[model samples]
Target: MDISTLLAQASSKWPQAAALSEPARDRHLTFRQLDQALTAFGQALERLDVGEGERVALLADAGIDYLIADYGCMANGRVRVPLDPTLSPVELLAQLRDAGAALLLFSPQYADVAEGLRGEGIRCRALEELTVAADVDLPDRPAQPPQSLASLNYTGGTTGVPKAVMHRHASLCAVLQNIVMARGAVLGDVLLNVRPLWPIAAVAVLAHLLSGGQVVLGGRFDSKTFIDQLAQQRVAFSSLVPTQLLRLLRETGSAPADLPLFKSLDIGAAALTGEVLDGAFSLFDGRIAVLYGMTEAPWSCYLAAAQMKALRQSGESAEGVVGRSLFAAALRIDRADANGIGEILLAGPQLMAGYWQQPGLTGEVLVDGWLRSGDLGRLRADGQLEVLGRCKDIIRSGGKSVQPGEVEQALLSHAAVREAYVFGLADVEWGEQVCAAVVLEGGASASVELLVEHCRELLSRYKVPRRLWFIEELPRSHYGKVQKKRLLEVLGVVAS
Candidate 1:
């Protein structure tokens, strides 16, 4: 189904139902209202002459406008490239310099951030000043053909340059299909977007909206606002990364006694620890589904909710499994020599079309109709997918190999530790040594000695951290992923 079809269907079938909300601004949308906004937006884009295949960059926080600009581009089939609202000027410029978008639809709140990138020579706008024609005649902007370019997903720069992965319209539809199948989400299912509007997670939220369920739009996941929305919006389902889920559980605890409205939570994007998952289950049992996904394909693989509860009831470690593959995506563990580890290969329509303008790189990963997920994972005998760690992120300590996720999971299990990251540091003697950085919970102190002893009970001697550094907070991206390399540098274990 094309984006135009999704919008048109929603407008026709659910004209009076709320389509979006900006509770903070006291602004909301019914289906008819959303339709008006899209028509006005399409007309406005026509005013700027945004034709097919043109790139439209949306630089804004998650709100009504962000979805508006995003859907507007989708409706007209303009490739939508979302910039993190929290990006620095340099960060924004790298994107601007790369894509050279024809039109930039930005919000006033982030207006200054956009202006800072003016040297890159791209047109930018505050959504308020942009309007449709007075007697707006909606120009019919067709959705891009299946083979046409649809999105440009930029990965964090490794060689000091961010690379955008491009996908065809068909591949984007595959992504939506995988998401719907993965979430078990179907018609009449409402989803919440309390996270950023970028990334693969956006695919799920958008599909829910397009499939006739309402999208409860909001900005950053403010604890109070989130709990209130979950209660008032009658939210059936939503998605989160582990970090966001941690904070949401804390907020949901303060939810009123009468509230039991939330049905399910789709969580992924970080290593799942026993403490975190158990804490999530304790807070919202039978409702949390930790997912294993990649931006390239199967945005979610194997949902570990009901399975986790069963495992817990049976006195087993439910946290060990990341669940089975979504309906469309599949996983297999072929590299046993790496200790039951294999490079995950995602094959399905859900895979991306290719990396934008980087055909060589795309060919390297998308081989034989499978997207080689750089993550190293294995499948349990019962068909559960267990992610060991990222291929590059796993630290090699004197050739024994140390999966930071294992050490971090053990560290998080400590009552005093709040957050942790495990990395290998250069060592003159042992080649590379395992170093861990941690944040103590509630500012409580814990000695590395205690932590090491705690880990020795659970992990092998070499798998434990040789050195530890305590920090107040881990450096995270806007999406709440710990930047390990950055952390190692900040702790003086590695050169910046």
Candidate 2:
């Protein structure tokens, strides 16, 4: 069944219930109102000649208009390509062109940026202009084939340029089902979402709506505002990347005493370190789940807060503990060595169809229905999974592959070290040399020699960093993954 059909059912079941809201803008929509707006927008798109399977690119920040345009396209049977408005003009244009979008929609704030894309020959429509009067008949919702393309979601571009991941209607429904079951979502739950709506957060929005929950949308991530919303709205659930979590911890110092309504806090899109987890547990008296997945497969594995507490109490390493696969997903380690470390492979109903307009690249990763995650990990004896790091992130020094995550974990184990990023730099003799950049905690101090000695105690000599630099913070992608490319750039070494 089409996702829109499920959404229609939700509106019918909870007509007066809050469906979407932007507190900053003072905009709120009940389920029935949201459905009506979507139908109106769908009618407007139809009048503009937008058709089934057509690509409509949306460049806007998270807001009511964004959600309207997204579901509007879905109701019209058009594939919506949501591009991050924060991206560079060149990057944005490249994706728009790659998707072969038939029309472009932009919010009022992005009118100037939309104008710049006029040269691309695509029809540009202001989001505000795409409206139908209340008296106009609503367009009939189009039938969406299960295998039809739903959205062209771009990857985080941590490894290189982002690829447009193609997700089908059925696949997305499967993902929603997995999240609803795993997260125990139910009617009347309130979800506070501060992340951008282009990719990951969109899934969260769908899961909440599917389970008949209220969604409180925040314009941008302000730690203070986020906390205030939790208390003010009695938000029951939220998702945050590690960077956001750390920032929140820094802002609040500890979880606010009055805000106890928040229930589940999901953290993912980057590795969750022990230090971050420790600080998070101190601040928020809620369940903190560590989720692990990529653009190709979402909600694949999750480590619940109880498991996290158990691991910490057991004094076990939680460096890459991403927990067991979801009930609807299957996970395996491909080409394991004696230590059972291998590339993480995933197969299940929720896996994306493939990358848009890149069959060669799709062929490289999707093999025989399994996605080559490019993430190296090992399944534990108890069925939990530990993601070591990306296969490409392995530092080859003197003929041995040094997992940067292990080195980073060792560095972070130091009492004074707050954060650490490990990578490889070009070395004529060694081919590639292990290098590290570290940030120290407040009132704490550590030297290169001290950190080197610390790693020496935990790692082999070859895995120890040959050089180290102290920095305020490590450069990271929007998703919170450390940008090794940027680190190499800072060191004046061109990454191979």
Candidate 3:
């Protein structure tokens, strides 16, 4: 069934269960209350003359209002186009124009931007205004077909122009199923979601609710309070990007022993180096897991907590291990080098319908029913998937190809290197030379010479970074994936 049906089913099955919560605002909604709110917002959309299947763009922070707009748009057969608040108005406008949004709904914080969009001839409305109770009932609309559009999620635009990944009701339902199976969310499971609700993390929020579980929106993540919330809410499941996991480790020392209620923590959005994984495992008592996928097909692979413990006990490096494909997804390698690594290919019901309004671009990735995932990976004999870096991120140094992830992992193995990003810089002699931008642990320093020498011991000659820059933090997208293509511009380094 579709997302709307799924939420309705949850409401019917557990009318009194806590469906959503915002601890910061002391706001909470039970299943029946959430369903009513969704219905009210749907009626509001109808009153605004937004026809069925028309796009409604949501640009607001994660909270009760954003939640209503998101579910209401979908439940009422309207396509939800989520705009990243972190993006500039130019970028946001580009997506809005691309999606052909019938209306733009935003919170009070975005009033200035909404006014600017209105000046540009786009219809804008305050999200809270629409949340007011509608006295009249909205006529029941026919259920959309499973293939009907559900949302337009734009890419992170880390590399270049952002393309909206078109997700259908069927594909998103598949994602919900995969998440439930992979994360094992029980009826009473409590999931603390601090990640931005506009991205893939929002799916996790839906997955939990659809499974009759409670979701606590833990506003902006403050490591200190994050721990307190876990203990207070008895949160059993949570997800984090690698960046967030790293910060939690540094700021909170280790997962406090008092947090016995906390259970699963899945890390995704970027690869996890062995160093960070080990530290997180220690901090969270092996509750950490690895989730791998893209905007095109989220929840593709999952490295569960038990498997992570086994991998660690086996003394194998967990650096690139992103676990096995989910039950509904199939994965393969397209072309391979001598080392058996190649671009990862994914085929599944959860795959995005295509890039919205860009059939030609969609043709590039969706070929023969399998998504050309652009990510490089190799499969272990035991069926686990180990993702290398992106194929676009490979460094051609002196006629030899080097994967940046391998070098970055080696750099992270060093005591001082807290975070490392490896990329290629144009060089006349080597064609392209490996370069690095690193963030050291607090109060820790390492010479570029020392880091280079350390890499030489772990990587081949061509793979070691010839040049390195120490920075306070790596540039990242709102979703926490490193923006590799922007490192040079962000670091103010020019290619030789």
Candidate 4:
């Protein structure tokens, strides 16, 4: 089913229910009002000569306007390409060119950037300027097949250049159905969303809408503000990456008593160290789930709070437990070694059709019916999955493959360490040496010798980091994944 159909269903069933709201602006839309706005905006797009299946680029921050435009595009059968406003003009232009976007719709905040892109001969229009009369009749909704293209989602370009992952209406619907069924989401549920809407996290918005739940949109994440809003709105569900969770824990210092209304905090987009996980469970009196998926295929594996607690209490390592596969997906390890470490492979309806306009690159990853996830992981005897690290992130030290996640988790276990990132640096004799960057906890102190001694107790000699550097914070992508390439640049070393 198309997203538009889902929205229409929600609107009809609960016309008076709150559909979307921006608490910062004190603006909200009832289900009926949101549907009307989508229809009007869609009609406006038709008047602008935006043909069906044409690419329409949206460059705006997360707000009411972005949501309306997104839904409007869906209603009109336009392929929406949401761009990260945080990217440079050069980066944004590359996406615009890659998608062959015919028109750019942006918020007032990005007016200057829109003009700059327009100066490069791209057609641009401010979203505020695209208004239609309230009584204007919307054109007939196009009859789009389930397999029709819906959105072009671009990668965060953390490891390399960004590539567009093509998603169809059916794939997204399957993902939404799986989530709604798994979470038991209902009309009264409220999701507090603080991440930018351009990324796959926007799927949360769609999921809430599909389940007839309310969405509370916030601009950027401020730990104090987020917690305050969560309490004020009595939000039931939310998601965060590891970096954001760490910051929230540090800022709050202790859990507030008023956040009991919050039901679940779905953590994903990066790995959560054991220290962070422990702190999260202690601070939040709700489900703390670790979600494992990529832009290519969401809803692959979900480690729920019960499973997390069980693993902790049973003394099983929580370092890489991403739980079991979703009901709608199947997972396997390809070419597993003696330890069961291998590249993860997934097959399901939620998989992306292919990388946009990159047939060669698409063929490399998507083979037959499975997506080669390029992530190194192992399946436990209990059927749980442990994502070790990325295949490309393995460090070969003295002919031994060292998983960065294991070493980083050990460093994080140190009382003085708040965050740690491990990478490989070139060495003449060893070929590559394990190196680490660590962020110390507030007012905590530790020497390199002390940290090395600590690692020696837990890790093998070769698995321990050979070099370590203390830093204020590790570099992270917009989605909060550690940018190893940027770390190498920060350390004044080029990757070999």
Flag clash pairs in model 4: none
Which structure is stronger by TM-score: 1 or 2?
2
lDDT of 4 by residue, 1-496 (tens): 8877877788779989988999778888888888888878877787889888889999988888888888778766888899988889999998989899989999988999999999998899988666432564344354467888988998848235569999888988878876776666787789988888875667767888778889989778888777887888889888877878888988886454467777778887356776777778777753677778888998788887777778878976576788888888999999999999899999999999999999999999999899999999999999989888899899999999999888987998888998888888889999899999999988999999999999999999999888999988788875577887778778777885
- Please give each candidate's TM-score: 0.90, 0.95, 0.95, 0.94
TM-score for candidate 1: 0.90
Q: Local error of candidate 3 at 107, Å? A: 0.9
Q: Give per-residue CA lDDT, model 3, range 1-496, as digits (tens).
A: 7877787778779999998988778888898778777888887888899988999999999888888889888888999888888788888888888889999999989999999989988899999998864455444434668989998898847235668999989999899899989888789889988888876667778898888899988887776677777888899988777777777777877644466877778888355666667778887787878898888999999998889888888898687888999998999998888778999999999999999878999999999999998898899889888887789888888888888888887998899988888888888999898988999988898899999999989988888898899988787765566776566777887754
Each candidate: what lDDT? 0.72, 0.83, 0.84, 0.83
Q: If both were scored by lDDT, which would come out higher, candidate 1 or candidate 3?
A: 3
Model 1 CA lDDT for position 434: 81
Clashing pairs in 2: 255-283
Estimate candidate 1's alpha-carbon lDDT, on a 0 to 1 scale. Answer: 0.72
Task: In angstroms, give how far residue 380 of model 4 lies from its true place.
Answer: 1.8
What stretches of model 1 exceed 4 Å from their correct place?
A: 130-143, 157-159, 185-189, 250-258, 412-414, 453-459
User: Candidate 4, residue 99: CA error in Å?
Assistant: 0.6
